[model samples]
Target: MNAKTTKTAENVTRCLKCRRVLRNASPDGYGPKCRKKVRAAARAEVVAQYKPHQVAKAQELLEQGGLIPLRANRVFLAVSSDGSATYKTHRAACTCPAGIKGLHPCKHRIAAHILLAA
Candidate 1:
């Protein structure tokens, strides 16, 4: 909000919804200009948090341990920001809502990681 951080100045335009930075920003405001860069930064964070090879190795461990099924009718894929997988028995009981609602990450995601690693 100060002198337009190089990041803010480069990637974001206005906030997608607010219109101020999407709401009350100049046509070339921070969010508008920096949105893509911001998105890339976020993506990098996600990737670093969840290393694919490590998580896959964890899944292999789970398979060896037999905590996770190879496939399930109700089973949903859940991955966490920290590279954890979600494993749940049921949607209602699932820590991740089985993907019907709450897109936010949940413990089910962690469970999957555990299962994979087991």
Candidate 2:
């Protein structure tokens, strides 16, 4: 290929997450560091928006597969801490007791936010 064609092909093979040119690109399109950094950044942004306990619970909820999207992804079903109940959650509202009070975003809401943000 000519020099122009070679340079254009290089740009097309950049890291998916950071847009940096990759010398040895992976099939998934992300460099190792960029992959980790992208995930960490998404998680960090969610954690930074809430209290520690809430973030922890949100992480638990996500890891446990407790959050299920519904209504074309506009709402979610968040399983309670004890797994005995589920709260209907939206981006700004949740049916959980803490959410009903409206004092702050509850764990369920935080979990939903994390899902949507990611």
TM-score of each: 0.21, 0.62
lDDT (10s digit) by residue, model 2, range 80-104: 8898999999869999999999998
Name model 2 segments beyond 4 Å from true: 1-42
Which ten-residue region of model 2 has the weakest summed lDDT? 8-17
Summing lDDT over every window of 10 consecutive residues in candidate 1, give the lowest-scoring window: 61-70
Q: What Cα-based lDDT does every candidate model obtain?
A: 0.38, 0.71
Clashes of each: 36, 0
Predicted candidate 1, C-alpha RMSD = 16.1
Most accurate candidate by TM-score:
2
Model 2 gets an lDDT of: 0.71
lDDT of 1 by residue, 1-118 (tens): 6565545444444432123334444432224434344334334433345556644543343223323233542353444334465444332334444334655333444334343222
Give the residue spans of candidate 1 off by over 4 A. 1-14, 17-30, 51-96, 99-118
